[model samples]
Target: MTNYELNMKYYFAPLEGITSYTYRNVHHELFPGLDAYFAPFIQPKQTHVLETREKKDIDPVNNSGITLVPQIMANTADNFLWAAQELAARGYDTVNLNLGCPRATIVTRHKGSGMLADLDTLERFLDDIYNGVANNGPKISLKTRIGKDDANCAQKLISLYNKYPLPELIIHPRTQKDMYTGTPRWDVLEDCLRISKHAICLNGNIFSPADHQELTARFPTEKYPNIKAMMLGRGLIADPVLHREITQNRPVTQSELKRYHDTLFKAWDALNYGTSTLLHRTSELWFYLGCMFKDADKYVHKIRKAKNIPTYQAAVEQLFEHCEPGGYFSAP
Candidate 1:
């Protein structure tokens, strides 16, 4: 590993409906390089109560030994504070604010990247939350996009973030308009690295060691000391050993991948969320995992199309039997 890779921290970005506590625990046990795991965003309600599943996800009992940072997605300061305090009481010291989610359902609700559309409202919300949680709650970090529509908005966004004493500012260098398509705006990220007061973590389009090498080559740690971490969501999901690959120069073997998959499947299946839910959940994983195998199109299609648990199992078996790892895995 290069000095840049060694000095950098690796965080697993939260993927809602995918990186649940069960998944986190399993991944933490199998993969050793991740510094922390951020839970999927919890959208607090007016009543200020966490759902049973949400409670379980953040529960220390379920996430022992892992450094889990719970993320809150709220339009209002009160809602965000309530969730932060709740986490603080549960022994969490750091909470991530989710301003990066670009899903239409979340954006339409004036949350996530939608909050970026109106800087005034966004600033007010930030001000209130920062003040409300200043003395008693967990410290707030922010995971955000550059802007709602224009990449250039990063200038004002960085200025706004500078006003606050954030522990870290995780930037996915894409506008809401850009979604996950096209290339990530590396120039905008460079600007953040140059000017942001808080530590900056890069996210987006990082899938392999080559990608990380290119990133570090561009923003060498010796030059960009404030670039504290890299957050991986889709890439990590596609290859659980990505961090190991980058940091330890280790490649994932087929047996290791198979064991990890089986272990994860058994854990989720034990939840007994019913066959349909199990199939749905496992299939969601395959959408990324399938990309790691050679000639996986037919098997992946069968897995996705499977209506029953038996069929799903059969398709997965065939995939493991016929396909080999080390295929060109790309982010989708």
Candidate 2:
């Protein structure tokens, strides 16, 4: 078998509300294969000020020892430029434009995937931002869905993306309306591989080592030279050592998972966000992590219903002690 670890770059996808800086730091320390971690979208307001939480999320001190690419979600060029300049000043070498977020709230605002609905506006916004950026500023990349409602929109979208000097173009290959449903538009992605001028990073539906192998087989580097990286979001969350499994072809041990769970619990607990916030945050993690254990639905439900820290900790302990690891995580 070919050792893909020697040839491919792995990026951790930016998932809002889950893959925060703390999560990134812990994952980097323990697993150690992801090339870059894309931070959740930072929606810049006209005020051109980063919120306290946003500042903390992208703070160099908070993100030390990791290659973090801060993402910006904006409809107008001014807001995008302001945020990009701020990130550049903070020493980020590249800023990712979030054009692929499929949430309805973001879409209705004509940001995210909604930008694909109006190619004219999208082109103009791109023009202004590309022209507005200073010569010495950080390079701009894009993360986009194929279209808002139709997959065919990728044709024009790719054309416009080709006009810019993007360092990388990360495509999720699903229309905004798809909203994580159905399989990703692989046919559309194949077209992008054949025609796009910039380096292309594939995202969406990469949940296992088999999936990674299938993608590599389908889009061999010799045939699709533009396909440079693979991005994992929910899959990586479900199995923290997923990158290791794919590259090293080894299963994660139960002891490693227990240690990771314990350390993560303590790290989040130390944030002192209070009992309610801590419970809510840890519960969100269990929603994904629960899938790593075989037949863990019963324990997972208990964790979710946990109202206090003691109950949550007890439920987690029961799960680790009783359930076996090595199960596949199917997206819910």
**Model 2: per-residue lDDT, tens digit, 291-330?**
8999889999999899998898899889988998967667
For candidate 2, give the lDDT of residue 66.
95
Model 1, backbone clash pairs (residues 3+ apart or across chains), number: 0
TM-score of each: 0.97, 0.98
RMSD for each of the candidates:
1.1, 1.1
Top lDDT model = 1
Off by over 4 Å in 1: none
Task: List, residue by residue over 1-332, the lDDT tens digit for candidate 1.
Answer: 67777788999999999999999999999876699999998889999999999999999999999999999999999899999999999999999999988999999999999999999999999999999888877899999999997977788889999999799999999989888888799988898778898898999988888888899899887888899999988888888999888898887788877877898889999999998898888889888888888888999999988999889889989989998887535754
The backbone clash count of each candidate, in order, is: 0, 0
